[model samples]
Target: MSRGAGTAVGVLLILTGLVWAGQGLGLIGGSFMTGQTRWLVIGLAVASVGAALLAFVRRRGG
Candidate 1:
């Protein structure tokens, strides 16, 4: 992927992770999803994915 595209993907992953975290923590508010722990688990996984994407962005020729 192009450098910009890779960076954007990385950023998006990080944001998604944060949102999932909020949902899990019940901090998102506004009656979004119906579960708590579920959000948390999903958030954690997304965050890991984001971190991996970031790593990918930082790798040589990425």
Candidate 2:
């Protein structure tokens, strides 16, 4: 991926990390779940987004 796309992944990772940490601490709602369900749902969602971004991001011309 281009450097900019890599940077985008890095930012996404940060956002994903923060969401998980917040979920662990009960600082934010997990949209469609409660308690442990929150962790599962949010984690899966974040992972899916990351994977999709990685798959579609421009891979040449950094």
Candidate 3:
């Protein structure tokens, strides 16, 4: 994908992941994911993927 697209996806993923993580940790409530260990794991994985994408973009000199 293009650098811009990659960056955008990376940012979006990171934000989404953070929100999920918050819900999982019960920091952000209201959803079924709240305080769920599975959500927490999923969130972390998503965030890590986002971070990796960002890193790739940076390494590409974007």
Best by TM-score: 3
Give the per-residue Cα lDDT of candidate 3 at 33.
99
Stretches of candidate 1 off by over 4 Å are none
Q: Clashes in model 3: which pairs?
A: none
TM-score, cand. 3: 0.93
Candidate order by lDDT, decreasing, is: 3, 1, 2
Off by over 4 Å in 3: none
What is the lDDT of every predicted structure here?
0.78, 0.62, 0.94
Instruction: Report the backbone clash tally of model 1.
Output: 1
Tens digit per residue, CA lDDT, model 1, 1-62: 87678778878988988888887788887656535788888887888887787788778455
Clashing pairs in 2: none
Which of the two, 1 or 2, has more TM-score?
A: 1
Residue 23 local lDDT, model 3: 92
Best-to-worst TM-score order: 3, 1, 2
The alpha-carbon lDDT assigned to residue 49 of candidate 2 equals 70
- Report lDDT (Cα) of residue 50, candidate 2: 72
Return the TM-score for candidate 1, rounded to 2 decimals.
Answer: 0.80
Give the Cα error of residue 53 in candidate 1, in Å.
0.9
